[model samples]
Target: MSRPRTLTDWQALAARLTPQLQGNAFINDDFVPAVSGETFECLNPATGERLAKVASCDGADAEIAVRHARAVFKRGGWSRMAPVERKGVLLRLADLMERHQDELALLDTLDMGKPITSALDDVAGAIGSMRHQAESIDKLYGEVAPTGEQVLGLVLREPLGVVASIVPWNFPLMMTAWKVAPALAAGNSVILKPSEKSPLSALRLAALAREAGLPSGVFQVLPGFGHTVGRALALSMDVECLAFTGSTTVGKQLMQYAGQSNLKRVFLECGGKSPNIVFADCADLDRVAESAAAAIFYNQGEVCIAGSRLLVENSIRDAFVAKVVAAAERMQPGDPLDPTSFMGAMVDSTQHERVMGYIRKGIDEGAVLRAGGEDVAGPGLFIRPVVFDGVTPEMVIGREEIFGPVLSVFGFETEEEALALANDSDFGLAAGLWSQDIGRIMRMTHRLESGQVFVNNWAGGDQSMPFGGVKQSGNGRDKSHHSLAEYTQLKSVWIALS
Candidate 1:
């Protein structure tokens, strides 16, 4: 069957909807422009075409957003609502999200160059995350301390007022839902700053939230460069909490800003140099090879937790590398709108060039290019998936977070050496171990210094488990009851008997 031609149709659909800047920032229960009249253009990464004009909010606008959020929180618009009522609103929001899945998916694909199929899945995941939080809210309970005296002591969780959540470009819509749903479920207003590279879905989400009856000022979308709007959010005193998912460098800067400003709670899920360790004892070599390729190439490898470093036991290193290289060769970079296309363009030209440069550096540094080591010339930012074998731990390709469809394979003879190689990097975001021995799995899981350790698989976490990283990968967690603490403050109530 022929592939359907739908890119132009999707673009037209996006053109029909009013752009983000056209609608004012949702603040104080109304839509209004920023204190500044500045604006920025959203670029379609696939074609470098102008997608839409978005608000270029400055510090003044951020101040207005935070103040409005504070007002709404104090007024009890969302915070005072019963848990069931809030759940109903969030559930309705999820339903509304489902209703507009096609539009949201199309916008996401056009703006971000993600596969249309993946974009649709992201919409579903976003809805699922929202509903998950809604259901989890009622089960959230405070703690009680046992006391010998007649006095009673109780601990309660309260909203942390306004939270500044900065989401990344790769999974813009789903990440925004991951941050906002839990914050709203915990009774905190949120000011979301999506990556300027991909703000279309976030703006659409803001509109949907309003349509679903979210109180004004309870949710706001600020679309601007990281230097202006993101800086404002990181340093805002009224934003009592800050949650970020991006690079460790920026995460550190935001941490410093938070320390200098309000000393607010900060949650970060930063970069990764995750290891996908393969052992000779593995059950299925073909499945392992396929999963490894998918692990590094999925979403064009923009994943923060991507298993970029492949540690293969020396016994089967040659064969495994051959299999992985063959699998990667089968995957091709094509127009994201093409349903059969397995890989899309990089988020932008700069990222495209960066990935290509890394490939060149790998060659220059003596790593063997097993497959795909060049850029595909095109109007859009596209690079073929690259794989490098015989990579040492000190090599740039093995140590750095490429954030592209590139894989570095390292060979180790002993299990201890595999663990050493995996834990060599400063990042500890996510790692996977492929071994048949249960004792080896347990030993590796305990030794690997990563936030998430997957055994015989890769990237299998739901909204229920805590997701975050250690070391330079950043701190705090997302997705689960633990996330509520990031958006909430604990208070202790003490009563004395006379």
Candidate 2:
């Protein structure tokens, strides 16, 4: 079937998707309200409707959760379980998530205005992350270090007690899976603090873990703002490790909290202002143009590794910008429930205003608006695909992370200039470059500071690849054999042979 061309059609489809949604904190295998009896309204960004009034937990609630998690960790009901047995429990939780895919999908779509189909698809990634870690349990082996016959050395990986994860709203379920999946699979009791903006999915996931026969306090969710529950978790001495995916600023705070308290291991996957380079030698201009548009426009450009900076070789700059602008026009925001809508609403009004403010600032700084510089102007917080040509490095839009569908295009004459432009940022999360030159590709790949680099593509990678950043973009990797290691600590034991 062809995509819906009318706004009414999209609206009708979205209307059918809206259902009453609500959830409380999930702790110790049950749903419970905040000790303070406070709650916050979860609003649908697409239509400004109330999805739910979720419990707003404070420091006291955080303490209770940590105490429970610490008790379970000490008891070792899960931590001491055999590898295959732990794997089975995690696999069952994944199965339960798959069974309730649609229900989980709807909660995220209504809560954060993510496209319903995309939300549904993201659930698969989350499930896959769980299953992958679960399946790896028994296969993982400890190392026998080379030593003299008189001495035997064993290096074993052991679970860190009471892991706490704080995930962002943009990709709620997927990010949660990246953190919690490994923590739980590694036999650590987990306390998750999902972003207040979108907490419903994580709340549901906690229940599923309980249903899958996880011990009490083995998996839990605390849905509230970062200042309260999140700060409390970061500062808790009982939480031996902290894994987070959010802003660089907040990631730094968590590190500080860890220092001030227990000095827990902190792993962060934070913000990015990743660059996408288009060189003159690329054979496929049309394909590259389309992908470049999608790189920044996908998820309304809320993605942490979004290619907000488009660096094109000067030879193809004018023509390429025109092609990219044309492609972006077709991707204007629509009802998130419409599967055909590649773009959706901003997570909320604050984000919407922030994007618009960046657009105005860019124009003021002399960036020529080549395609779009406006909102869709309707019920939702939706923006049109914004493209700015003739952007320079000094411009605020060119330098800062917009976290919107605002594309800033810059032109470079040589590979050296492109590399310089790409490397000149506080972020090093991911970068993409387009070229047919093998030597250049090899050199650029070596020089690029990002954790991941794509050759001739944008955001192309598999589950096995590590994801994270360097510099202010934050530390530690997620979603690979490496992530499982981050959730654990290495112990070395030596035995003297008789």
The candidate that wins on lDDT is: 2
Off by over 4 Å in 1: 1-24
Candidate 2, residue 22: the lDDT equals: 45
Minimum summed lDDT over a 10-residue window in model 2 is located at: 1-10
Q: All models: lDDT?
A: 0.86, 0.89
Candidate 1 positional error at 375, Å:
1.5
Worst 10 residues of 1 by lDDT: 17-26
Candidate 2 lDDT tens digits, 168-262: 99999999999998898898999999999999999888878888999998998999999999999999988999999988899889999999998
**Candidate no. 1 TM-score:** 0.96
Candidate 2: segments with Cα more than 4 A from true spot = 1-20
TM-score of candidate 2 relative to the true fold? 0.96
For model 2 the local lDDT of residue 423 reads 95
Residue-level error in angstroms, candidate 1, position 260: 1.1
CA shift of 433, model 2, Å: 0.9
lDDT of 2: 0.89
